[model samples]
Target: MRFPHVRRGKAEEPPGIVGVARVDLRTKVLVRRLEPGDIAVIDHADLDRVSADELIACRVAAVVNAAKSVTGRYPNLGPRLLLEAGIPLIDDVGAEVLSRIADGATVRLDKDVLYNARDQVLAKGVLMTEETLDAAMEDANAGVPTQIDSFAANTLEFLRRERDMLTHGIDVPRLTTRMLDKHVLVVVRGYRYREDLRALRPYIREYRPVLLAVDAGADALLEAGYRPHVIIGDMDSVSDEALQVGAELVVHAYPDGRAPGMGRLRGLGLDGVSLPAPGTSEDVALLVADACGASLIAVVGTHWTLEEFLDKGRPGMASTFLTHLRVGSKLVNARGVHQLYQSRISGWALAALMIAAAVTIGVAIAYSPTGPILGNWISATWHTFAYWFTGLFK
Candidate 1:
């Protein structure tokens, strides 16, 4: 093994940010391989907040996108996050860049230009900064009305198509892990999931809610020292180790009954039941909890706001919105649970009760026939302890 400080007469690096180039057409799949100081070359257009957050977490030195990072589509939060994180973003570098640059190749990102290890120029594109991001956001803000209209149309279409399921809840598969009358915690690796999970630790410990992990959210639960009762998703992002942790896997399928996840599970010699649904995995998980007769459904790392809905970059968010309405009073955001759900026994009350008990015991000891004997025993014990403590110094 080589140590950094032990190396002698090392050559000076190139003039710009130098790192290995990790390229992929799918941003989400690509993020898993990303390591610190690696340059991420993706073909993502109008990158969403979740994908951007993943890239930021990977600590990629720079991001080179084949498509526009913000195509003025509802003010995408990805580019802004990357900029804020001080990760250099080269926008709209074109698809040729993906083909030209091989994965694992050492590349240098100098301003807007990308160069190979041999210092050969590969591609050049606009380097996004605060000014460019702001301008693009301004244009995106102007286009929000059009996006909102489109979103509304999609929502109505979804509601019309899934009217039966939304009205009466989706047909949930029978499982050994019962959720009836119990608080079910549905976890998704979305907005503020880590922070929200940290906040919900007390609630989780107190209630011992049924932990239901959605895809990669299973890994999150495992990281937080939790084992999910059931795992639901398309089975694309979750780790194999998480799948083998004795959790029941429910693969979310398309409305037409095409379950892609089953193929993956079968390939791994694992068994899972399929639940054909219309919306995203997050939506399906919520519906499952509601349909399973859960008393309360607490969600962690799930979207709640209009901005979060837009940030998802999916038309199926309409289904999520409808799912919340269907779940009604049963659905509660885990973030707010701490404020809403208060324990019956408070620390102050318990402390006061203990103090009262002590006072009553003291009074009884003073009035009782054996009170003098008890008092003498207590006083002698205290005197012995005090003497032993002081004698240590001598």
Candidate 2:
């Protein structure tokens, strides 16, 4: 997709750029309710690629951000992605615009200026373009060293706080799911999650592994026709239908036992056990699988690389790093498994082979010397059964 180079202070009008505005402080939550042709108004700063992808999937006509899409902290790829997808992006519109504009109100965009029905200007923001994005990316790249230093410091602090849990595996929540001596598949809604799951279809069918989903990954599993045996996460992104699918719910809470998600469960009239730990939900899911003594754990779409961690804007990747260390031997990346494993013979092929074998056996028997003896035996048995049947009816 190609985007026009937008010059700053240019007053050129974009053709037919009008739609209902959908406002939300939380981009992720807003994305769930977003519909195609609607203008997304969000307060997200330095929006990540994943969120951008979700918004793109929703097919929003445009995005208006209250905060800077690229703050020069690091090269966040979200704004660039949206622009490249041919979606209009207006940045630094200020948070006050969210309060002034009501949700589902029709708004028109004339270049960078947003107006209500009366043509009154509500907000003005800078239109992002290829030149500006490239410049911002260069600045962001120059700032990576400082970000890395901050990341290291945060990781060290996380390691210090989570040492006991990592080393001893103490305080891991007990689960009723029998993971011991059985394969456990942990699905996370991360990069290429749907593609990874599609590739692992053979593995899923052959092993019949215990399906464990983290947040929206539960919906992914359901879409793939597999019911999650256990659902682990903060319960924010997952749908209510997924929660009511009868899977065991495990809520990830703070170390101090503050579970913000518990209220949602209570509101849903659902029961869940709290797992207090300091880490991402995916990390907690891995820990749960290891703690439950899974023979092998296959992970799908979990972030691994430093860039991926940074893309997620998660400063506590030290916990994920430590969790991997604890579950070292058993954990296997599903992406690797998809590449290496051989495809098993499908059920239809096996059935066809069995039918072919049966036909061959029948042809051989018909031409064999013992064919006459076999026919005589069959005739005698039928006659005897017929006589018995006639006597019973009489």
Candidate 3:
């Protein structure tokens, strides 16, 4: 089949890029199995930074996205990161290409066209360039005011819907961990979570707070050498291995009582309970702690800033804002706590401090009238030790 080249301008062609196609409807799931030198076939719209970071870490040869990489909704950093990493990005290739191309099929990306081993053009897409991406980012920045207005509207709508649940309390599921009058650490797999977890090591060791992981945060906890006391989320991002680790699993269901993730758990023969809620899983986790009467709830890796909420690409963050307000006095962001709390002194520093104190004491003794008495005592002790040594020899 003959395919027309949709070249935009007279620009230099990108270098040879060829690899096996790894196709998945969900970018998050696809990233788990992606390897270096493989072309990722994804259907992600306005690809977020976290997904892009995962793709970059996989070292993919190129990305063939079936949807628009940037819709000018917000200045998402995903496409920019891929381009900065020297990875070719082909956007808006259409959903038909996903069917035309088979998984594990060796394909060559020549300019903006993709060809199979038989030299048949499978699909064509716009190859993103630095100039084009920069222009799109500028446009996205200009649209920030509109996005913020929309976000505020959504937040108000959420407040109206979930006011009672947030203010009163959620009917929390029974769990093995008792949070009553205790400190609870709720970890979410969001911004700088690993670094925050590293910093919280001393606190975790000292308090032994209930380790509550939200979705993939379970994996994060396990990696940090702590088992989760409760695992709550939609159960999509978390691994089956983490599910089987014996933590109580609570699936976040829609307000209308629909639980989609329960099928996956039943398929794996794992037991879990469903908790109907309107907000994100992290929000539900905080509510669960609050309902369980936790004295203090420390949060790690949860979104706080407006930019972070935008990065999430979801309007439901209005629920997050309300969740914070409801959990008020009890909720403390772990990021801030980590920054303020001073860690225990190291052994080397402690030893050096002790040495300094001993030297100061010795100097004070030498200058005071007690110097002669100390000198005589030291001499007598030395002679006694010397006599003991001589007697042993004899």
The residue-by-residue lDDT of candidate 1 on 206-269, one tens digit each, is 9999999999999889888899989999999998889999999999998889998999999988
Q: Give each model a TM-score.
A: 0.83, 0.81, 0.79
Looking at model 3, which ten-residue stretch has the lowest summed lDDT? 1-10
Off by over 4 Å in 1: 1-12, 336-394
Best by TM-score: 1
For residues 1-394, write the lDDT of model 3, one tens digit per residue. 2223336864443335768899999987887788899999999988887788789878999999999999899998899999999999999999999999999988888888898876688999999999999988999999899989989999999888777897798998888789999999999877667778988888889999998999988988997889998999999989888899999999999999899989989999999999999899999999999999999999888988788788888899888888898898998887765566765898899999999999998898899898989989989999999999999989
Cα lDDT listed for each candidate: 0.89, 0.86, 0.88
Ranking by lDDT: 1, 3, 2
* TM-score for candidate 2: 0.81
Candidate 2 lDDT over residue span 1-394, tens digit each: 1113346966444444788889999887798789998999999888888789888989999999989999888998898889889998999999899999999888887689888866678899999999989998999999889988988898888888778888777466667789998999999877667778988888788999999999988988998888999999999989899999999999999878999889999999999999888898988999888888889999987887777777777687767877887898998888665566656998899999999998997787789999888878878999999999999989
Question: Distance (Å) between predicted and true CA of 286, model 3?
Answer: 1.1
